[model samples]
Target: MCVAAVSTVQPVLAQTASPAASADKVDQLIKLLDDPEIRALLNKQTAAPAAEADTSMSATEFSALGHRIRDHLRKIGEAIPQVSSEFMRAGGTIADDINGHGPLGVFGLFLTMVLIGLGAEWLFHRIASRSRMHAALAQTDGARQNPLHSAGRHLFAVLAPLVAFSLASLGLFMAMTWPPLLDAIMLPLLLGVIACRFVIRIARLVLIGPRTGKDVAATAGLVPIDRASAVFWYKRIFWFACVFFAGWALVGVMVALSIEPGVRATVGYALGLGMLLVAIETVWNRPAAIARPHGRGAMEWALTFYLCLLWGLWVAGLVIILWLGIYALILPGLLKATTAMARNAFGGTPDVPGSGNPVVEVLVERGARAIIITLAVLWLAFLINKRSSMFTGEAMTDRIIQGVLAGAIILLVADILWQIAKAVINRTLEHAQVSTADSAHAARNGRLLTLLPILRTMLAIVIALIAVMMVLSGLGVQVAPLIAGAGIFGVAIGFGSQTLVKDVISGVFYMMDDAFRVGEYIQSGSYKGTVESFSIRSVKLRHHRGPVFTVPFGTLGAIENMSRDWVIDKFTISVGYDTDINKVRKMVKGVGAALLEDEELGPLIIETLKMKGVEQFGDYGIDLSFAMMTKPGYQTTIRRRAYMMIREAFTQNGVVFASPTVQVAGGDSSSAAAAASTVKTAMDLKKLAESGEGA
Candidate 1:
């Protein structure tokens, strides 16, 4: 019985196993083989070949970029009808909202919010009207008073109403419930409106300034641009803001409507073209006073081409290249314009010495620069995030983009710090400028002047090095190794260039010791001159005789500072032996008194010139020692004047300067007379020869 049953089961199984059943068995077997280990093994086997295929495909795509661009353009052209439909649909949505099918439709709700906001803004404006008027009036006298204060007041006055409007509008919008579609569209629109209005108001304040009276000429704007330029820019900027905000709102609406990405890109390109045209128009037709001169039309054409290239890059979705071009073309001009505007607003005339507040000027300038750079960095980050896959090798592109953004931020921060440091150092130097008027703090001022420049240079180098290192780290470089290598290299260099190290070290010590300062006369070995300036390793010495020497600090040993405190000058004057000592002393005293009474020389003299008895007996006569103490650098002049006065006094008082005398004894009178005559003739001949030689 068991044998018969087995035989029957085998036949039945064979009959059931048809082709479809076999195929099902094979699929089950494949599923059983699909384990993680087996899949990983298969991937490993095909990885190299897949990578090669991807590389080839990337190369092909790169080679056919123009074709792709053309195809994209064709797609954009074909989607024009769809784009129009989408825009019409968006308009219809707004229209439907305005038709009041529901309570407080989008349009009515927006209108109510705007009206409330405007009313709030109006109330705020009325409340602050007196302050605003005062700020406006302050503009006329801004240059005479504190310009920063005036600018701040005006800024506050202008911003108050806008703040009130923003708060009211945002509060109302948030408080009301909105449909998802209308919510998305209305929020961006409202925000864009508020932002646009704020931008326009602030731009107007900066460019057109406050206007209290009817005459536009009375406007004292922060920037020194002429009224025509102000008006032109104000109008152009207004239009630009309108277009920008409108495009922003449109993009949001299209996004809410689920428009095709290609159509959206096309619309964006169109808006960009509009912007480009506006820029071109502004560039070409700018006021002559503010416009760059294009005498040969080269600059204008170049600018136009550059702008078009930027647009093309944008169209091609080459975000990196587009941003690089923008930064290259725009950053320097923006920085310069911002700085100039800040200086003109908060500072006095740029060319005038000590005219402006350095702190305020640098703060405003660097703050503006920081804002611009931050905005640019943020925009670039957004572009990278949005178009990360626009380039091949997405990982590398992301890293590069991140590095660039970080580097830009690092540079901006470093620049702000450097500018602030530079401003402080410069201001200190300006205050430390040596004055001709004698003051107790002259030495301290000179020392400050001498050391601050080197400190500033060193500080700049340190900031630059640190910023570069941070940027390298951001770029994914092994900064630890680089830093170690730099340290080693610096050590090697220091060892190799011992003289430079010595000079630098000596200079530092010299500054610390305050041995010599700028404008002080010092003598070291054979080098004697007035300190003109200082460098890291050397001091510039300007000689009294009009030669400049750059002497290494290491070479300057045992410095002799001649222009410190007071200088006592002494000289010997021989007088006739027959002169009365008492009378001569009295005459010298009179001369000293007269010198002290003189207007020009009186202040220079610390102690009047005095005759210090007989210094010694000379062959000609007795040598009287004359000494005077006077301020440094004026001692020589006073000594010269004293010599002249003494000579005049001696001549007037019949006190003759001594001369050589010879007496002939035990000789005939005629012989003696002849001898004297011969001596006199010889002396006269010698004097003539000496005069001739002098000439």
Candidate 2:
């Protein structure tokens, strides 16, 4: 039996190297670079010797020397072997043997892969069951009815054999003889896994009813859509990919049989191409959460339809065009349709007929563009698969597809990696407040919480850039010009906005230093307000006068913060010196008791408003100060409320008002009345009840 075509580069993996050769190679390179001949060739004199001669060689001579050196290097390069590749090649014989035969080889591979898959499922499920799921399953009222639990099992059952079949194909190819009893064994296993999947899918569907299914589906905005369905379809697509790969392997064996002879070998290339097409379709076909439901289902349906129609039309067109001698030219229409679908998938905004909703358009656009690129890939795959002896487009399409696939893979891998990183960051944040007792403090974390987003963003940008460079390199595209262009643009922007950039950078420092925080009442030059918003460049403060003052971090020179922690408002209602200090203190304490008794808003106050004796010795009476730690943003309200209450309580206690009159050098009532009337007329509006008609 033949092994399915295993990884061609597995033995020569680009990432790995052998220990013996790796060390020896490094030493040899270092030794060679330091050798007299090599050193003289590489060395450059800062200044030429006074009697320097023209030592330039003739072009022909240089060319001959270059040719000799290259030939030697090529021989050396051919001698090197990798550790991973050595093992991979050791097993490649199974695939080579299977390729020597027929369908029987394929069957052998299928069984082997199925067994491997089952082993993996058992291993992971054991881990999950041991950790958290076991306890959860026990507590649920209807554990058997829990669809989530059922879905997990269904996935494992279906994936086990699919995986086993692929691996078995590899093993049979490596270990078994050519064209052995592989297909005969594998077809049954393939059918068996498909049957298992069919059963599992139906079971999950049965658990989905009108009421219950709606709830599971409703968690979409936060998680994946059609959770069970997506899981089921993802598994199906993976199996289909395996099946396609296997079919290609069988063709490879047939081609091998006639390899020595002049049998045209286009079928293996075509099937390999088809495998790539199915793989692309499989990746983009995934269901995602539709946070904005408007046009979401339609977009998904369009994506699905595009895949099916393109696949069907390509097959049909290829057959017709070959028989009828025509290209059919359906590509433009397909391209247009895909472009529209891409735009819709990634570019739609939520249909909220209002402003200030959370914008999710960026995600949509990103998703849509990704889908379109995938669509173009499948299209190219079709073209490559259909190319004939005349002007075969395989080479060009293969390069393009390689680049596209690399980019898509990078995006996906980056997404998964970012999620893992975010989880780590969140866990670290949680660890900080694990022992905090206050409800708010228990939630507060280190400065890392703020830095986490920045770090993630920086990492994603860096990884994405690396991915882009790699994709370009894979497609043989030069990246030097692009890098140079970017550097130029960065320099230009840096030079143009030097001051604005400085302000932004300085603001970041301001935030990091905690110069000021939200909800603090502060007075700056021309701005006495409470902090409402803070950002990298500026902060917004709302004033009591009904305006928002925007202050740049660079411009805020000094500030007076009255309410950073606790504020004590001093109150002085003068009483005659004869008034008992103990009595007045007792009266104030009683007022505090009455306030504490008011259960309606008692929690808002940290402690009852209390009196401190003689905040200052006033001219006519004792000045007293009162204070309490009220909730933040309640200073003005509490101050106003306390003032009114104190006035009423003082009236009840007969506390006198302080007069700034020197019993004013004898009582002159008429002069005093005239003076008071003049002051009222000049500066204040007088509102009076009409005379009672006594006249």
Candidate 3:
């Protein structure tokens, strides 16, 4: 609408009473030729429009037609003198006619000036006045900057949108009636005033942020460029406004240049985009100044300016890409450095002795390494971009070359990091000097060994299955069909593997319950040995004599961990039953008393150890059972030491150790005597046989 209206601006420019404005707007030359000097200027620029040629004519025909016309004209005695008059009448020969010199021309020019240009000017002045006035009121006085004043100011600003709404009816009426050039700006303008209330809101959150709203603006360094930002906020608003304005302007230009419209648009857009990119790069990567231009603004202002600049936005995208690239480059090296730094900072790995503050040290090393890698990667990527742009030629070939160069840089950097990581891991392994890995890894290996075969089977199965799925998916099999097939297959598998599943479930519980742990001697399923490995399907044991046995968990229905809880130990002394049993009890009590006072055993023993009494009375000796509660796994050592102490104490008391014995005695009858005795007692023998069921 605007450019179509340019015919309107042209007349307004030509007829303008002000000489200076007309001088600057030379397109108003028809009206401007009212000035005799400008008329001469228009005459010098005059040129004839080309004559129309017939569409059906070929080049030769057209040339022949043109020759025939010239010959006819010559026959009619045609010359420049007569042609000049016709051209003059047609308003091409004379300069005064160029700016439309007729009285009707003057009326048309004046009318257009009033309709569009003058009308737009009037609205411009009107809105500009209102904008200025609104800003003035917002900045009334700096005296009331305290909380109470701030509160009051905020309350008033909140009410301002309502006030603007009331005046909007009048503004809208004027807009509807006059239909000004910028009716589009009115709604956005009103909404913006309401938004100012939000800026004031920042002042209330002083706990975590700055106190003054001006501080935010100061941080943005927007104040010097705009004293009225508190009221106007024009900087942010104008960008949005201009974008719509440019869009409207673009449409107008496209309409005017419609003959070759695509070419025009493509060229304009490419050039515009290129310039924007150049501008963004220039400012975004610019070195920070030694000091602020005037030291009157916060750092945020500089950053915001950089952010808003064209180059800054363009490079900001590059920054993220560069950062990711660098991370891919340097992150592996940094992670390796982190692990090494962890060992150094903590004195060793967490499981190793003297590895102090392992948790904290490990975290700091890893976190710091991650951050450092990230920053280095970003910096390196930026360096590459700058160097490539500067050193490379400006050609399509240059872009490809730069891409190759960047890929090479990333690959080379990543390869170096990989080498370093390998070195670090190797060094760590070397220091341990184990035929196998050290205790930490031994524990891990023990865990993995327990799972390896089962995991190996599971992984192989899963990989094969996934490959099948991939092949199906590659053929464009729908997920629904695959999932449905999986569901059915799972049902079939569940039915087929029921016993195995049951074994796995039971095994998991047994292992988790500490029914048996690896390296602990245990008896389960009539098989007794030290536990070698425990898996979902099976349990493994290395027996005392050196045979390894694998038992399915389903068969391991019962378990007894001899190594768990405490051991009930008994030692015998000959003649102990007759030799003052009460004194013997007191002597064992003394032993228990001494053990209770020991520092290490004191905490481990939940209850005091005691001799329960002589459990068996025999002809030669009495057997005693000593009972004690000991820490799990430590019970074996505790029981051994306690038994040793009992033996030493009993021997000192002259108590001789006793052993169990058996004696054979002669019966009432031997071979012949038994036969005579049985003959006399045949009835008794028969009764005996009957009692034995005829045996």
Candidate 4:
């Protein structure tokens, strides 16, 4: 019985420990179980009732996880009503405290506030209309003549309403003696009105600017238009949107004061539905109503897309309308602020180069905009979920927010690093340029500049790739598979393009070896030119005759750098055989000395010209060879100057230059003398004839 129990236990343990057992392990277990003595003992001990085994543990755990999620969602759904009831209770208490006698008393208070707000707006507008500053700002005349005039206008537009609201609030506090509770309830209404007006003012200031004919150019402005009609309609639509928002603010206050939270949300949803219908009606009546009369194609497309979706879809329509409200009424101010912040971060103002540092500036501005937009989107999502519960539930909402925040952080970090890298590169390039200007190291500095671009490009690509990976991971995507797939793809590419790989490798090695730098004249194979730039696998060479050559590193062999540290120039000049060799040598040396003393050539000349005496007796004259050393790229200029000076010096001293002459001397002296005498007699006879004609 004991042996049977042991055999049974060992098999059960082996099965549990290695369910997908290897062949060897399976054989070993079988052999143990099948031992003749053990098998006989087991059969005798009976089928001592096999113990029941439990399975399906993994399935059970999975079912439990699903149940937990469902229960959590149900709990969240159940608590939402309780939250709404609390808000309703709060609203009722506030109404009871404010209504002195009944709803009529509260109505009268609201009417009075509306009248005060309107009255102040009218009075302020009238006063501002009389000022020359406002007049100049409104007319769009002489705006470019004085930039401050336009700025003053934008400032007044933003500041005037704020000041008016402040005064109205003060008067409300001083003129009436309301209960503290009433003040608290009504104070929020006043604050909301102020905020609405402030938004309208800023939006107007940003979207509308001093007119440039039909166009507008501002620090924060929209694209320019070519027609006055388009501008006029754009302003009308913008103002209409602003007015709508202001009225909506008043309605929001009314809802807060009198309506329960559930009823308020229901009314908002119904209003959204009604607005969708109205939008459809407006577009149907006039297809071009949303489109600008003479706007760019992009603008027209944007407008068309907006209108089509605004009225075509159900849930998306409402959300788009809400986003449109934010864009027209809120985003302009944010954009203005972004521009100011970007400029200020670089200092109060940017220098020419810094301002032109579009990479860093654009990155900073866009990063800031992305952060603000992300926050805005999160807020909008929360609000939408609160009213509609359309976003699955709170768990999903939390996950979405978490993912967005994580992605934002990754992008911001990437943008910041990109900007820093660019700034460092720009600063380094500036220092190099200043240090190497008009010096022998200029070519080297140019090469360094060429490397900077490649470095910046690589850095940007790396940062962007990392940011993308982190964003994907934050969104719960599996990145390991993507990385593995990318590795395989890279290997495939390497195998397919062997020549490309060879070129890139050779180019990199060439750069590391410092064979030649940018801006240097070099010759390799049959191509010779000045180095214009470098690419990943080749160099751009600009020829002297205005052609650009792109030579791959793999094709280059035996490079000859013409513009290195120094260059030696050699040339020959022929003089008459009768010319004194010592005199000619002295004259050539004097010319070299004079060139060395020249202000421009003095620093370039490392060694003055030296005559190597007569090289050989040529057919016409004795050839004199001379050599000189000068700075690279300056040798040609120095040589030309030396030739000119030597010719001038020899000419002034009556030293004659060599001329081609032929004399027949192979025959006897008598034949040569007879030929010479014949030529002399013919010349004498011609002279005698001319003299006789003169007499």
Candidate 5:
């Protein structure tokens, strides 16, 4: 009737709006009345019609559907009175309908069921204990090994008792065929038990995690808490909360079963107060599992942030106590299964130590999590669609769901990409470690390792930016303004941090040019040390005396690598003029040849030492210079060893070292004594020189 009325109005309005209602306008308006699409559009613009036509169902079919629904409802309405009279007759008693037995029979049945369930659980536990499956779970952490299998172990550990209880509850349900006991006691007990099991298992998992390793078992456990505190919280606060929440749910079931409103309200208030207490206790015993980042005033900030986050999580936990009754019981097992699948698909054992591909591992783990979370969200959305009336006719709900799904995909893709980049970089560094003794090869490896951190940072930034943009797009947000803002921000940062930019760019160029590799001893002005590592803006050089100098690439000038290529050392040796010059030269040459033949120093020496005879004629002696080419950083040791050998050879050959003498005129006994003293002084000097040389 409403659709007909609206259809009548649109044509009249369209005709009246035109000054002249031509034949064309009349025809168009008449066409609109017959067109279902036009009527549907009009219905959307106006109020919805009382009875909208179902194009799929004919008039006769729609009538049949309505009749069936009315008939079913009529049957229910008719049965309600009958059920009420029977309920009144029973008067909520625990009496059996068949024998008129009271509470004793019901209690006996309950006890029997409990024993049966307990017996079954015990038998199963024993079998599991002896099984190889249990041994596998005991040995491996199972995260990277077999996620599904590990998850199964956890699920079995947590859910086995619950499953047994459920079976027992089912038996009790069947045995208590008497309506009164079934309605009043059996139903409430069953709900309470199930709710309690879920709460307890989820709480235990959250507080201490699955029995994997002490550390891994605490992965999802309360952070920053000691074992004692964890035990205390579990026993004192969490257990209480679980029991309270379960009992509260039982009362809610009672309320649903027509319990007194006053009693229900009282129980609700009590539950609320108990939950508040639990939240307070949780805050008081905040876990110390997470560490604060190092910085000035960081601890305070971390504390504040974690406290707020913890409190919020607590509040959320309370709010979802009933909801968890749905998910907490099932999602964990499913998550484990999905994780196992991912591990099987993407995980592998590395062929060598440190060879495991982190990319594949991260991608597998994160991808599995994302997939599980996405599926879980979608599943939840589907449940909400079926159970909730809020989104039944709302078009915006669909848009929101789409937006959420889009954002998830964008984030997932970004995460996978980031993981891939990191894996590539890590794999490169791993391969680079196999470099040989060749300088170029080692330098290449060093440069590759040095570039990893910077590349990771760049990749992260790019991936994050893309992810943000894609997520915004998914959410129907305009990206143009954001892009413009980002550009402006970049310019501002570029200008404000010019020195940082310059340093980073200089470092980048230095890496590209392969100026100096890590571990090479290089000198830049006065500061010379071994290259320990490289950062985005600076290089760390460890000095010989254990000081680390962080030199910015921009500040470096004229780099001299002392550890590269060959080094030539030249030094002069002074000898007595009366000494055999050819013998001394032959001796020096022999020293170099002997050094080249030496097993320890042979590899370091590039060329034999050669003499430039009689480099200079000093007043005390004739100076001869010799030079030898050796590997970089080996020159000092080679020079020292060569000189020592030469001095020893000279001493054995009786070669005299040069010494200064003073002349004295001989005329009297005093003059003769002075000349004797001068001669004795020369002899003493020669002895002193020999002693110093030997020492």
Candidate 6:
């Protein structure tokens, strides 16, 4: 049986072996395995039942985890003492380099190089000082006159010195030669200092603006934070940067000394703890001038707890969970804060619409957010790859990480596009708000304002749907079915809610026809009012009185826009039949002339008030027609003023308005007198009754 088994396996083993292995070697291995002793051992192994794999968690595993944790803690405690030794070793190496190179030690040499770089920076600044000062002056002068221009000038003024400093320092650092150990230690240290300075300067420029001995309120800084909050953040950021860079430098030195990973991690954690404390302090003690939400105390406590939890996770080496927390909680807030800060800096006032340079604001805000999200995604990818062993397999892990990153990128791009679209739409709407007296321009602007809002809403919905589908696709989700399902659902909705569809379609056509606009007075059926605003399917009409009507476009059939280009208003007045007709025409003509020359109403009057003709013969007098053409919305006011002027002119010329009169004529004088007396008494009684009712 053993011989047969060996013969069966030999060919397979030979095929699997290296080509260098000869047929004789393979035969020899099979012959050895075919021996009685090896055969008995293999038979014993094969006869025994294999131990069932224990997949469930047991007490033994728990105990093992506890032991590992204890060991890790012990290692951390032991690693503390090694830090001093590592520093000593690095210092001794530096000493050896100094001793070999001349009396000026490596530290001193680094300082001298830094000083030279500073000298170069100073020289550059000196030569450019006049220009920078002029730029500052220009910025101050044009800050309100032209905010975008002033912002550009301020940026140039702030960046020029820093750019010069960076170029000089980096150039000089590259020109020098140093020992390998010194190079590693000093280069990062020098770069860290330069970077630290640059950050501080930038923070200063943003929070405090150009240093012209002005108060924070008077400064031209981009941020809209108060003086106390600005100073507080500025100081805190400076300290935070110092702590971070110092930790980084220390880690670099430790790495150069070949310190154990455990020791380095412990030291790094300690530095991180310090930074965490600083952050906590800043959070709790931030200037009260900064706005806070309701339940401020609870929010602070929650944030503090979250920070502590994050620190604990880092210390426990739960990098994946730590990063998840950062991304979920911290990243959104950072993005929002960055965007708001950018807007406040660029946007002149919160109340003013389209106050900022949209291009610059969007670029800075969206670009910064994009960079932040990209860096975060890349970092998470790196962490996942580093710990890929914890997952199922590298290939599957890579696919998942790629999917998540791709989804993130898609969302980021969508966000940028949406923000740009919003900016353009909002800018258009802002420009559409014209406060002009020109009827044509006013009407055009009103129409633009009315349509743009609804268009903006539709655009937002479309963009959002597209963005959601794209994001899902990036995450490896099949979107074809989703689209089809959405189409079917929309059809169902259209069938079920035909009224809504009718309203929306009607609104579109109404806007297309330019039937009525915002601020125009219109009437359709009984729904009549000035157009206050518009929504997707409805229009808000503010009545001339106090009432407001929200009428849907479908119901507003055949709109009569009263406040259009011009209105020709006609009114009738009854005059005494005995009055001279030519004299009355002459008086009306003079009244029209006076109206045309009136300061307040002249501009509104297209054609002054004039008597068209005698409208008709009335019961007691001749009714004369007067007509005037005036700008829309001002016809009533001008007409009222014209009435007052005509009344005064008639009074001065002895022209009397017609009134009801009774004339009794009869062959018998006594009978006629009795009829007249009866008529007079009846009219007097009617006047008395009306007076009593009024009182």
With a 3 Å backbone cut-off (N, CA, C), the pairs that clash in candidate 3 are 30-99, 220-301, 279-311, 280-310, 280-311, 280-312, 281-311
Cα lDDT computed for each candidate against the true fold: 0.84, 0.54, 0.51, 0.67, 0.68, 0.79
- After superposing candidate 3 on the true structure, give the runs of residues whose Cα lies further than 4 Å from its correct spot: 1-181, 185-484, 487-499, 505-522, 526-552, 561-581, 597-599, 614-624, 644-695
Off by over 4 Å in 4: 1-188, 204-245, 257-360, 380-444, 488-502, 545-547, 554-558, 593-612, 616-620, 657-661, 665-695
Model 1 regions lying over 4 Å from their true place:
1-47, 50-61, 64-71, 87-116, 130-145, 167-170, 271-273, 289-296, 348-356, 394-396, 434-439, 662-695
Pairwise TM-score winner, candidates 2 and 4? 4
lDDT of 6 by residue, 394-513 (tens): 464577678878778777887787788777877877787848877677777887888878877887788788888877776668999998998999999999999889999999899888
Best by lDDT: 1
Given candidate 6, what's the lDDT at residue 91? 66
Query: Count of backbone clashes for each model?
Result: 0, 40, 7, 0, 7, 1
lDDT of 4 by residue, 220-279 (tens): 332222344334534554554445454455356545555444444444444555544444
Residue 499, model 6, lDDT: 88
- Using all chains and alpha carbons, the TM-scores for the candidates as numbered come to 0.83, 0.48, 0.32, 0.60, 0.54, 0.78
Q: What's the C-alpha lDDT at position 417 in model 1?
A: 90
How do all the candidates rank in terms of lDDT, highest first? 1, 6, 5, 4, 2, 3
Off by over 4 Å in 6: 1-74, 84-106, 130-179, 210-221, 226-228, 280-285, 289-308, 323-341, 349-356, 388-409, 665-695
- TM-score: model 1 vs. ground truth: 0.83
Tens-digit lDDT track of model 5 for 1-695: 99999999999998889886589989999998889998888878665443454442345564664565466445544554454454444444434342565556655755666566667667766666666456656667645545445556666777876686677665656675555534455566555656666677765654555554445644444223456655665675555656575666557455535644444444454465565465445444544433324433554455445544543433332222234343554468556654554554445554555634567667766776677767766765665555443232345566566677668777877877887788778778777878586877876787777777678888898899889988887777889999999899999999999988999898878887778877778999978899888878999999999999999888886788887678889999888888999998888888888998999999889997888778899988988888999988889999999889988999999997777755566558788787878788888999999999999
TM-score of 5: 0.54
| Candidate 1 global lDDT | 0.84
The digit string of per-residue lDDT tens for model 1 on 550-632 reads 99999998999999899999999999899898898998899999999999999999999998889999978999998999999
